[model samples]
Target: MAFSAEDAKTASAVWEKIYADVEDNGAIVLSRMFKENPHTVSYFKNFTQLQSIPETASAEEIAALAEVRGHGKKVFSALNDLVSHLTNVDSLKATIVPLAKKHATELKVDVKDFGIIFENLLHLIGQKQGGDAKEAFEKVTNLIYEEIKAAY
Candidate 1:
């Protein structure tokens, strides 16, 4: 689904708020994704131990969590780039296609995993920012997922 100009504007404004603390928020989204769908962890070799980490984590677990946070930052940064270009479909598609190809080919990420990420991200936005932000982001995320699926 294509986002209207107003949808893009609203999503961009909300994204600015989230991106201010992208590292922490992104980590929360990824952590929530793993928790909600344990099967998805198999795709991340480095984070395979994520599910096994205890509340009182060991130093190793701490390092793993830190890595997850770092990866989360990268994930959100990519999203930020896409959201910033929402008003220009050509620019957005150019930016997303390469990353989608990398995930599909290099990472061998299952297409279904994108849906998991989309749902988790929406949940995070709804929980932290409220329904309006979630609604705005939903369109952007749907586009992202659709583009990725097509690329795959």
Candidate 2:
């Protein structure tokens, strides 16, 4: 999975919208993942806390929700950083190598889980930005996942 010139151009443009939406949309993306694959949250330390809360509970009511929201910001930022370096393998590796190590060793996030991330991300991108934007997003997502999986 190489990043072609066209993919870089497309991703560079689409990333702006993604960056803008992340603050509000990141949690939604993560929430969708949690809703779809509840067991996946086991990778996180607060898994039980997040699961115990009622779905309708407010952020203030459930501390785990707030913590997850914070995690969403970090995820979005890392995604943005990775996409920003799509044109250069060295730069991309620089970003992914440490993240891959951390995720695999410390977080214990399996490489296969990235597929779920990709699917949910695709859904989120389609709902917010369709057409070429979705295509670009897919390329970016695949690159990030593939590179990270390789390292992990």
Candidate 3:
């Protein structure tokens, strides 16, 4: 289903707050992602650099976390653009097509991987803004997943 203009507005506003939090805590998100699916990290050439730190992280671990955070910023920057243009179907298609192609072909990302990421993302959003925001995310992310799956 196409997202309504109201949905787009809600999503755009929610994303600004969520993206800010995500940009700051991207490493935690990545850490959770890696913990749940270690194989996902293999897609990154720098996966080996990640430190297995818990209570007390060393300098190397800190650096690795920074790297993960940097990657998060890049990902969310794209997300910011996509969300910002949710009301524009042409713009959305332009962004998702190339991104989906890279993900499907170069990264060989499975559809299931998108589900996992979205699940965690929604959970994070739920923590921040409760049900309405998640409902908006649910609609938008499903649309994104469908678009990506089509390209795949």
Residues 79-143, candidate 3: write the lDDT tens digits. 77778767777778888899988988888877678777777677778888998888878888887
Across 28-141, the per-residue lDDT of candidate 1 in tens digits comes to 777776666666677776764565663445433433487678988999999988998888888888998999999889988888888887787888788889998998888888
lDDT of 2: 0.75
lDDT score for residue 119 of model 3: 75
Scored by lDDT, the top model is 1
The candidate that wins on TM-score is 1
lDDT of 2 by residue, 1-152 (tens): 66788878888788777679776666766776666676676777565567675365554344337766777778888888888888888889888999999989988888888778777777877887886688778878887888888899
Which residue pairs show backbone clashes in model 1? none
Global lDDT of each candidate: 0.80, 0.75, 0.71
Candidate ranking under lDDT, highest first, comes to: 1, 2, 3
Runs of candidate 1 exceeding 4 Å displacement: 48-64
Q: Which pairs of residues collide in model 2?
A: none
Candidate 2 least-lDDT 10 residues: 54-63
TM for every model, in the order presented, reads: 0.87, 0.85, 0.84
CA displacement after TM-score superposition, residue 66 of candidate 1 (Å)? 0.4
